[model samples]
Target: MRRQTQECKEYMEAGEKYLDCQDRQLTSVMQDWPKDINHLLLARNKIQVLRDNMFSQFTQLKSLDLQQNDISMVEDGAFSGLSQLTTLLLQHNRLKTASEEVLLPLPRLTYLRLYDNPWSCQCSLDSLVRSLQLPSNRNLGNYAKCAEPLLVVGQKLKKLSVDSLCRDDNQVDRGTGGGDGGRPRLPLIKVKPEATSMCHTYVFPKLLLDCSNKDLDHIPSDLPSDIVKMDLSSNIVKHLRPKQFLLSKDLKLLNLSGNSLRHIDTAAFAGLLYLRELDLSNNSLHYFQYGVLEDLYFLRKLSLGNNPWVCDYNIHYLIYWLKHHPGVSYTGLMCSEPQEFRGWRVEDYVKTYNGECPKDRQTGGMDTGQGGQGGSDNEAQEVAGETGEQLPRPLREKKRNRFEIIRLS
Candidate 1:
């Protein structure tokens, strides 16, 4: 049995010239080291540590993989021996810090992957991102962020604007009371002197314009001609210009959820003959004319939940649309009816209050939508609570205004 086991091990090592240690339950040292090995994959091992000279014998190795490990640290010069190595994968690791000191030795490494790692967003990380963006720098841009306070989880590094991603850090720290000596820690805005993407345009792909708490007071005028999906979720827009909405030919999805939008042009969405989903939730709209949303023939998913809806005769028109539009979904929106008539549904609303609105009550601009401020981590908690509920007042206030489609020219 002992000889058979030894033979099995020998055959396992000799059976193939390349070894894939990825996702292997490798917790300890292996018994035999194979020669002439060119590729070594040790990813997803759940390894926390690497011993000295782990791969010293594989002198001909060209590619190495080590992803999805619990690796928080690397012993000094752990990979100093791989002279001909070109590709290295170290993504989804628990590395809090990785620097040139650990990587300056690899001469031939051209492609390296270190994305999806839990890198703490602090000044320490500043040096990392900057160095990575440098065209001449080595293996710096390979790493991606694991947790950003704003963007989706595990997003690619090259896709997101670093300025926007880093902006939330200072604001996040300020709310934690990390202030020194009683000084208020104002959030730091990420400044990108050169903010531009490689114009990889797809004819009006979905516009992921998440300008929540940005310095933009207006919209960029040069919207793509085939913008089928538009997301203006959080910005300080006061109004939608005629060119902003009316000119787009194939706008299918429109989201004006959180802005300062008080009113929309009755003809604001003239050219959007193919609009399907329209979200106007959490705005400063006290009244909406029926003609505003009438042209949306393809509009199926309509959201108007959090606006300070003054359940009046005008609401009857919107309710009439909702009652007929089977695809329309009104998620968790509420109305403050007169003292006696509260908690109204869309079906009954048009029946009893069609062309009928509450006139006597003097309407004041109530909390924009719900109590929510910008740049506060607590505001994130508040938004979490309103996920399917009313739109946060702060986000609503930013959407009311529009710009001349400001281009980055």
Candidate 2:
């Protein structure tokens, strides 16, 4: 009989290990994979249903890519043991309905891509919708719309009210986390003295804690966990430490505009998986450090106007990130440094950064003219110097794995 399954092996990227099974027409995961794999790529496959405990062995898995598949149903315990999973991609599938229980095992999930799926917004989907609509989960289910039920068809799943989905009004009311409700409530934290004394707390019309113009150079300790919005604009805070907002997991909007902010740590926004709107306008930031924006997986709107943005390869990371995330709308990214590129748009400058040299300079190999002999090398070095880095090598080239079997002579 022809072989229908292959041994699960390893793949390498940037010196890290992962399992790559992309573009394979398989229906299920192959057996004998290492239990310690941190990344798994299974895109472009024919896998339909996810049975229970399908990935229970990979306890150390951190990211799982299941995009571009025919997956329609996921059993409740399919991901039962993936407690360390932080990123899950289930987009471009045939999932019509799912329960919050399916996601209970992924407590640390930071980036979830559920868009491009045909979601059915009916009574059975109320629980999932309610969970996504919570203030702490604002970044979870994005761009997911209903495909069934004519009345709610095409409506976003995050905005659909639970009362309208179910016929029983009392059940819907209880589901809203009222007294004796099924959903657990977030623990109430006592507002610290420093926070209460400096910030103005407002609960009506939405919970907003305004700490703007506080004339403070540091953030207050023990911020209220239930606040949905915070205003810390026009402050003198210059540096952001790592995990500064770790306790503010429920924040959906934050304004740090008009501050003297010049440096931001890479993990300054960690544990803020649900933050959607951020304002950093009128700051002194020239460029962001690599991976500074890594934790903001769901940010939708950013205000970067009036910042002194420099035109260099160091600034390209921000533009590259924005290009990949077209959902995020930003403003004021004109180059203000390196006089020659001043007044130029950041995107236009990035295009010129990759421009090639003239053909004449490249073809001056044997000519005894002014640009002969070592002209190409000089020009290449000049180009590299201008870009602040050398050319990148191809990292995605595919190579066939070789295997050898030995027998006793």
Candidate 3:
């Protein structure tokens, strides 16, 4: 019987058909079980134990699906020979960590899915976490949870610290705390620049930048002069000034999501001749001003969703603006405001002013004769919600568990 089992295993290694090892309740698998099996599907099985040399022979295995198993511990070097393996689906498993040495051999691997597993989020798991930080490795950050009571407190598997999340059984540390404990002393990784990133190669024409969490309280004074796209999401900015933008000639897409912007000077976006897409979603903007977008004649998309827009004398400007601008996409957006003005269009504010802006243009005499923001035309209106009252920040630092929906309230 042993000879027959070994023969079947070896037979599969010689480019023969594979075993139907589904739901086999395999408690212990042999090291040289099946060396030639190019494809293995051991999903929904009771396979609890896997040896280091278990798959050291399948050099050509491209796809291995070991999902939905009772695997608790995986030996080091278990998958040392899968150099060409591109897809590894280990979802719904009981395994905790896959060592660095074990994964160092997977040279051509690209996709790795290990979601819904019991991850300890320790330094012992640093190998897998470090594997993802490599510039050559693509799409490796999947479903990594911060375990619990740690720096990252949640379980959607976004990113686990390579050195902070895991334990170093091999090394000794004097730090006091449990595995996946202790605050991580690292900045959010910025892999590539917004415009020239290899990841942005596909979305080159429309790229997103991450100037957020760069510890910037104000917009950078030296932004790209001719950028077509910019993503300034997740930052701590309080207000917008005209000198902040230094507008680009071809600027089209701008993402200001997740910020502390309480006020925006309307004339701040003066030189954006080709501006089209603007995303102001998920912000602490308690006031809404139509003049910020007044000069954007070609502006097609504007996202004021997730903001507490109090309907005052000028709230009608937005409805008037919306009525004129068509084909704009609001991402599941809604307004939470005056019962009468609730769900109103951007063109609704036109009643207050006869197509003329209500801006206090007298304030711009000291600056450019054109005025700061909201200074473009004589028909401009003053910003409606710039009452020096600042609202509390809804988003916490790295607290991604909150509801990040920016809506018109």
Top TM-score: which candidate number?
2
lDDT by residue (286-346, candidate 1, tens digit) is 6667777677777777777777666666667666666677776666345555434457654
> Which candidate number would show the highest lDDT if scored against the true structure?
2
The sequence of per-residue lDDT tens digits that candidate 3 reaches over residues 152-244 is 444334444445554544233323445546645344343222221111111111333335456467776535444567777777877888746
Supply the global lDDT for candidate 3: 0.57
**Candidate 1: where are CA atoms >4 Å away?**
1-212, 354-409
Off by over 4 Å in 3: 1-19, 28-35, 149-151, 155-158, 161-163, 166-409
Q: Where is the poorest 10-residue window by lDDT in model 2?
A: 400-409
How far in Å is the alpha carbon of 265 misplaced in model 3? Answer: 33
Write down the worst ten-residue block by lDDT for model 3: 196-205
Tens digit of lDDT per residue, candidate 2, span 1-409?
A: 1122253447555554677667878788766767777888787789999999999999998888887789999998999899999878787789999998999999998767676677878877888899888888866775667776545655778788788887752442343455764585334344223433455554323567788998868876546566789999998999988987888899999999999999998888888888899999999999888888887889999999999999999998898889988999999999999999999998899989866655533323322232223554465455447555443213435453364221111
